[model samples]
Target: MLWETPFGHYYGDNRENNGNYFANDISNFYEELIKKCNFRIGEGFYVNILKNYLSILKEDSEYLYYFKIKPLISILECEQYLKLSPNKEVRDLYLECLNECSSLYNKYMNVAR
Candidate 1:
C-alpha cells in the first residue's frame, strides 16, 4: 500500500509501515501518473492522494514525526519535476508538493538533524 502526501507518495512493505517507504514510491508514482493521465486528472488525483496521507499523518503524529526528513527529499524531487513538466496542472501540483515538502522539512529539520 502507498500513502500519498502533498510532497509525494510513500509505499511500504505493508499498510503498517507505509510512511517508511517515503520518497521512493512517491517519485515513481509521480513519474508514472504524469505519463499515464492528462494533466488535470493527474494533478487532481495526486493532490487528493497527498491530502489523504496528510490527514492520516495528522492522526498519528508519532508514526510520521520521525520521518520528517523524507518530505524534504520528496519536495526537492517534486521541484525538479515541476521544471520539466509541460502540463500546467502537473507543474502546479509539483509546486504545491514542493511548498508542502519545504514546510514539513523546516518543521522537522531541527529534530531530525
Candidate 2:
C-alpha cells in the first residue's frame, strides 16, 4: 500500500523534508506487515506487500536511509534483528526483507565506495 506515499510524494525531491515522512512510512509499514504475518494472512500474500514496500525503498534514493541504509547499519551494529513470528512463513517474509533490503543497501554502498 505504501508504493509512493502521499507524504513522500509531496516532499518530492526535498530529501530533508522527505526523510522523516519516508522514515515513518517505512517503519509503520514494516510493523504493520509483521502484524499481518502474525495474523497468518498467508506467505504469498504478505510477500507481495513486503516486496512492494521494499521496492519503494529501493527505488527512492532520497529516502534510502529508511529502507536500505539505516536498517542494514542497525543489523550490522546489533549483529541480528528480532524474529517477527515463530511461524516459518512469517520468518520467511522477514528474511525476504533482509535479503531485498540488503541488495539495495549493497548497491548504495558500492556506489558510495
Candidate 3:
C-alpha cells in the first residue's frame, strides 16, 4: 500500500488492514518484496533493493525511476526528520545508496524525458 505522509509518499504491505496498494499483480509483488526488505534493513537497504529492481526489470528504467528510485530518494531526504541512528554498516550503505541514486537520476531522467 502507498501512503501520503507529511514527509512524502511511502509504500506499505497493508499490515494495518486498511487496503493493499497494487498497481498491478506482478508489479505489486515486486514492490512488496522490496518494501519488506527496506523495512528489515532499516531503510539503508534501499540501495540493494534499488539494484535488485534494476536487474530484474532491466528494460524498465522509467518504472524503476518513478517507483523504486524516486521514492527511496525522497525517503532518504527525510532522514533528518526521522532521526534514525543506524549502525555503521547501515550508514555506509545509505551513503552508497545516495551516491548511486544521484547517478541513477542522471541516467534515468533522460529516459523519462
Candidate 4:
C-alpha cells in the first residue's frame, strides 16, 4: 500500500504497518544499502554496491524505468575497473560479485522487456 510521509509518499508492505520505506530516488536508496555493509568503497559509484543495487533493480520494476542510466552500462564500467585490479584478493572478490551482478542484470533486463 502507499502512504504519505514527511519524506514523501512511500510504498509500504501490507503485511506490517512498520514495513520499510523504499526511497524514490537512487541516492537515498543507495545510502540505505551502504548502511548495511561493513566495508565501503571510496571510489566508483555503482561498483561499490553492484550486487545489492542490481538485486534491488530486479525487485523494483518502477525504479528501473525511472533510473537515469541503464544499470548494465554501469556494471560494465565496474567490470572493466575490477578487471584491472593488480591485487589477487580484490580481483577474486570482483569476479564473484560480477557473476552475481550479471545474473541480476539479466533478470532485471528480462523483466524490463
The candidate scoring highest on lDDT is 2
Q: What is the TM-score of each candidate against the true structure?
A: 0.37, 0.35, 0.35, 0.32
TM-score of 3: 0.35
Model 4 earns a TM-score of: 0.32
Candidate 4 C-alpha lDDT tens digits along 1-113: 45655545555566453444443454564555454332334444435465555454455444344353356546545445454454444455556656555555666677788
What does candidate 2's lDDT look like per residue over 32-75, in tens digits? 65675456445457556655655655555543464535754464
Query: lDDT at 40 for candidate 2?
Result: 48
Candidate 3: segments with Cα more than 4 A from true spot: 1-68, 80-86, 109-113
RMSD of 4: 14.7
- lDDT values for all models: 0.55, 0.57, 0.52, 0.51
Model 1 stretches with alpha carbons more than 4 Å out: 1-72, 75-79, 110-113
Name the better of 1 and 2 by lDDT.
2
Tens digits of per-residue lDDT for model 1 on 23-111?
A: 56677767866564455345367556545544533443342453754754554464464445656655565566556555555667666
- List model 3 lDDT by residue over 1-113, tens digit each: 45553333465766554333323444555565555544756645545764553353343445355466566577665542122334445455555556666666767667779
Q: Clash number for every model?
A: 2, 0, 0, 0
Specify the highest-TM-score model's number: 1
Root-mean-square deviation (CA) per prediction: 14.4, 14.3, 13.4, 14.7
